[model samples]
Target chain A: MSKGRIIVIDDEDIVLISCQRALAPEGYDVRIVKSGMDGLKMLESEAFDLVLTDLKMPDIDGIEVLRIVKGKWPSVEVIIITGYQTVETAVKAMKLGAFDYIEKPFTPEQILSVVKNAIAHRASE
Target chain B: MKTKVKKTLYSLTGKLILTIGAMMIVGSITFWYFLIYYQERELLKNSVKYSLSFVDYVKKSTRYGMLTFQQLLIQQTVEAIGSAEGIMRVRIFDSKGKVAYSSKKEEIGTILGKNDPLCRSCHSESVKPRDMQSWSIRRDPEGYRILNIVQPIYNEPACYTSYCHVHPKEQRVLGLVESDVSLSLLDKAMKRQKIAITAFVFGFICLISVVLCTILWNLVSTPVSILTQGMERVAAGELDYTVRIDTRDEMGELARAFNAMTADLSKAKKELIEWGNTLEKKVEEKTEAIRKAHEQLIHSEKLASLGRMAAGVAHEINSPLTGIVTFGHLLLKKFPEGSQEREDIEVIIEQANRCSSIIKGLLGFARATSAEKSSANINDILNSSLNMVRHKADFFNIKIVLNLDESLPSIRADASQIQQVFLNMIINAADAMDGKGTLTLSTRKVVENGNPFAEIEFNDTGHGVSEENIPKLFEPFFTTKPVGKGTGLGLAVSHGIIQDHGGKIFVKSTLGEGTSFFVRLPFYEEKA
Candidate 1:
């Protein structure tokens, strides 16, 4: 089977580069977008199995990305990544059909586990 | 008494001094008036007597001169008059009104005419020459002429003859002698005497006035001026001012009294200053004592709150331990390990885990860990506190009304500490209502004393605290509950917690009506 395609969006270049490097060696075909609009454009042109996006970003945040992914491509799973965690934010992400949430400064293993779980769950669906 | 004392002192100095001064002034004035009046009267009387006596001497001298002239005329008037010392002219006139003989040859044949009133008197048909003894007139040349000694020539030697009988046809006639004397010398002497007496009286009065004025200035006015200056200094608040008067009379007494008054005033001022300083010190000591007592009350309240909290924590821990002990006993009785009955033991183990969690909560309460502060919504704290007390609220059948403000700004505080304060307040409100009446909770943002704060109010329809107990409501272990039902640390702990967060709590209660507690917390400012 072909490896799943994952898109990571972050406003910070360092975060985008680090996420891409962490997930690239994990056998997933990882793509990076610095801005929310670029991530959306990439989503419209290609197929992504999963999208991991920062909650707070310019133009479109992780929540909007999750909404669009669910609306246009229901098969793609989305997860939220943020440095600060709050109950209201978690509840909002869950309401928007985000697969799960992972806090920033998360270990490589934690990221991989959540992404795998989201992919397996999406396949099952 | 103070006014009386002041009046007495004032009278002793003021009245005595004034009276002495007034008496001295009045006595001096009377003495001067009488002395001037009597002395002037005596001087005037003496001047009048001297003038009158001097004029009498001049008149007596003129009368004597006239009497000697008449005697000379009577003795040898016509020719012997030339031997007189100062005589100028003499003449004799007959009863027929004719100049019989004259010192001036021109007047020898001249008839004294009836047109002359003096001749008419002597030459009248019924004239009595003895009644016309002496007469004087001014001559044409401004010389004084004296007419004297009109005598009757009688028919018999010593017969008191009537003029009509003696002067019958070819009868004897009386004759008159006239003499002229210059009066300029007498006039000059009278004028000189008058000038001398006038000069003497004026000089004496002037000398007396000068001497009296000098004595008054030296004896009275100088000492009085010194007294006035000393009094002015004393009036200007120089309490030690004294006057030096050397006189041994009334003015000296006045100076002594003035010195005494100044000494008394100085003593009084010193006493007043000492009293004022002592009063200030006493007030300061009283204020410090009150401050210390207030602090002690607050400290005692804190200690009482601590004791009650320790008891409550002990109670809370005991409950969980009882639960753990009971669960462990049931598990052991039900089954041994490694058997099918182990399944039931697992369930017992889960119940035991729940008891451990409750013990952890008790530990957290006991430890009183520092709160992590953040900007938190007030409603969330209220809701959590309500949730914690909801079971007790339902058990007591109390209805709670929330009038929370929706747009209240978040406060910077420890969320859990705020939750604990809210929980204690609500439980206190529910307990105050005795489990039945309504409890109202409200929140709003308000400004107090020019500072912005979040205000939370909890009101309960309960048997309220008495007026005497209202001040002690926040005191720890001060409860209105039955002996074992309440620890009384709830409100006290709430007070400390809110105060630690830079907030304040106030309670208002009416007996048998209700109680309301207002809590104010500061707002959080976010830095840009």
Candidate 2:
């Protein structure tokens, strides 16, 4: 079995591909989507332990995705990916039951470490 | 009050009445004196005329008696005439200057010289016939005023032809008939005339004085007083007052002119007050506009300095830093757990991480100041900001005291940015305290310069900032904390955010006592 099931959503290819590449080797089953809409469709079709979503997306925003996911899958953890412009919104996301947030230009290890912790926390819960 | 009374005493009316009354008094006294003198002269002339008539009548009566040599008849005639009213004594003096007959029995046989007072009326010159007719007045020893008239009897043809003739035909012989009339009654009448005329003249003078005073008061004093009162009212700033003088003289003309001047003054004063009010309003508007412009300039200048350098550099570094950190982590896995190449990749990744964090700070400092403003309560913002800092505060052993005012009004501001600014101030206070202090968070209403504002204050019992460093506290990259403990951009970003929201930040600190940072935002007004 994979360490944990994860979905990464981003409008940027580099951020989405990097999150999947960084977390897959760490034994977490990583899923990637380019938009918040595709990420939500993926969540409805499958089961996931955590969701990492970019705040600004082409179709639907990260906050709406977060709300729908937390309302539907209360056990699933959500991590927001924010740039400098969206950092304040990321904090607001935290108030909406998001687990944590990671700023842009983050390293692979940084994403791995946060994912490991979030997965471990979900398992404990 | 005394000056007013004195002013009235010496007023135009007083002076005019005094002058005219004095003139009238002087004229009336002069006229009265002239009239009394003329009356007295007429009375004396009447006395002289009556005395001459009495002397003629006595001479005619005594002529027959003297020519017939009837001494008793002549004496009886002189006595009978003397007994008439206003007659004192009557006598006849013979041509030899002897008393031939007398009304007084003691003087019947008395002889008188030509130089005697009784004979001197007709005999002052020795036997001068022209002196035969004369009148004189004297006071007797009994205190009676007497008029003495002497008539000389001339020898007519009948007298010379009579048996009593004692001289040749050409001789002129005469005897004097002297009459003394009592003047006591005329004296009494003259005295009564003097007193009556004097009283009448005094009353006439008084009436003339009344008429003159009334005329002068009407002509000069009343109009002048009205003008004076009007001038005083205008001087006292009552320009609406008018002098009402209905006369068609110079005084009335002056009053009309005075009223016109006052009207002009009132108009000028109204215009001046209007200008003053407009000037005050204009000054306030200009000052408010200038203040807004100055704030805009400061915000723009701050943004230009940081944004100009921070934009491309941060973006360029951010794009590459993502690749460097992500790939560097991916490449680190290629080396052995303890290899030198792995450590080198780790160093690159570590430094790239540091650059990433710094670029975020720089981005915040260089961000646009366009705040999405809405109606926000300062107390709510303060509470939310406190919630964000509560964990750090508890870790630092900070006890937060809340002194929020429930009645604080809402301000027009970006709620998030305002909360961010508050977060910056709170974090700074916690850092300055070095893990042990109390922070008092408060929100209250304040009015400054007549504009209502909501004030949020963060008072920290921390190792306060020094006076020398207070001015530089809001500058980016200026920090009192240790190098890694702070980014040094919190206060600078906060200052920019507060300014964008039309608010101000003020800080006061003592070296070891405490520090207080106040954020003031104007209360939102709903008028469009």
Candidate 3:
């Protein structure tokens, strides 16, 4: 079977690189963007099964992106990534229809497991 | 205003002297009146008796002459005695009521009336006398007093049967003799005596009054005045004043008693003043002690609040530490067992452990662990905490310089807490510099309030806090750092720790230049 398609959005380049490195090896197709604005442009052109986004961003935070994606494609599941300071924001994003939340500097396994669980949940739906 | 007691004329001594003088005057006056009256009466009696005796002698001498009818001899004898010193006149009246013989030649043949002054004594309408000897005292119109005496001669057998008067024996012949006495000399003598007695009495009353006045002054007025003056002084609040009366009477005893009472009052006043001074000093001392205790209580409350804040910040830091540790383990799992990558990951793991230990220390504080103290060198504690952050400072391009004094004494303190304070200050300094400056840590000996202290200074070449923000730097949750960069509890916690160890932390800074933090801890003095 083909792996899931994923889009990662973050202001920190390191976090975007780490998420890309951890999620790509499972045969999933993942694209990385440096901002929530760029991530939304990518979602407009291509359909994505899951989106991983940082809650705090320079232009358009993750929650706004989640709101737009849910309004257009209710089928796509979004996972929230947050720093220790923005944990409360990550929770708020979850209540607003995000799939799950993971703290930043997360282990590779932690991110992969949550991403897998979100894809399976989407397929079941 | 002082009030004066009114003086009275009826004082005790005045009344006494007045009464005595009045009685002496009355007594002396009565004695003088009676003495003059008795003398006058006695003189009058003696004069009257002598005149009567002379008249009788004349009568007897004339009896013989009358027997021979010698009227000239009778006249001579009467005239002789009548012209004597006190006698004014002499007369004889015959049976026919004629003045037969008279010492005054003008009255030799005057007929004597039954109502004449001399005869009226013997012959009045109340009693017609047959034979009577009478006398009278009268004042004539010329203002002279006179005494008149009358003696009646009765018929005798020898007279009737005399050879010259041979008539029937049935006829009776009678005559009278009278005398007058001048009293002007006696009146002059009595008047002179009255003047002498009056003068003597007046002089005596004057002398007695002077003597009585002197006695009153010596005995009553002088002593009473002294007592009155003393009382006035005492009433005017001159309690130290005394009266002096040298008399051996009740007044002298009263003066001595008043003096003793004044002395006692003075002594009691002195003792009360001394007691009041001592009480004031004790009250001042107690006030100072209570003020110090109150300050200590306020510091303890500050520490307790900081402790609670430190607990919350610890939890915040723990979350990030967890992230760092988990990712480091994951990275190690992806590397070979002995690879350089794993070795680098170990460094990350080791720093994360350091972070956890700091959080653990704060948790311990939240648990209200009693502070454990030991003799500790402040310089050593500073160096150890400094080593923990040395690598972090190196990565931030911050340099630390030390100027510790080797001779500084150790203090009784909790080493971990002291180290924590030093570490926080160093990190805060590095942060203020924005990762590029120098931090200087120094320790030396100093004194405050007669107590030896180990003084530590952390001077940072960093952009100091603004004047408005400096005062708030030590307050919990006060920060200039962005969110997630700090919880703003570092300096607050550090201040609590230092104060807990009986030390003080103070900051002085200049804007855009630097900040210097000074910590002073009292040195432990061993009991001798």
Question: In terms of docking quality, how is candidate 3 classified?
Answer: incorrect
Model 3 whole-model lDDT (C-alpha atoms): 0.78
Q: Residue-wise lDDT of candidate 3 within B103-168, one digit each (tens)?
A: 787888888677876666667889867476666678867665676666777688888788887434
Which sections of candidate 2 miss by over 4 Å?
Answer: A1-125, B1-9, B118-132, B139-145, B155-162, B167-173, B210-231, B243-255, B289-528
Question: Which candidate achieves the best lDDT against the true structure?
Answer: 2
DockQ of each: 0.05, 0.28, 0.07
Q: How close is candidate 3 to the true structure, as a TM-score?
A: 0.45
Maximum-TM-score candidate: 2
In terms of docking quality, model 1 is incorrect
By DockQ, the better pick of 1 and 2 is 2
At residue A87, candidate 1 shows an lDDT of 29
Model 1 chain B poorest 10 in a row by lDDT: B151-160
Error of 3 at B207 (Å): 2.2
Candidate 3 chain B lowest-lDDT run of ten: B1-10
Each candidate's root-mean-square deviation in Å? Answer: 18.2, 15.2, 14.2
**What lDDT does model 1 reach?**
0.67
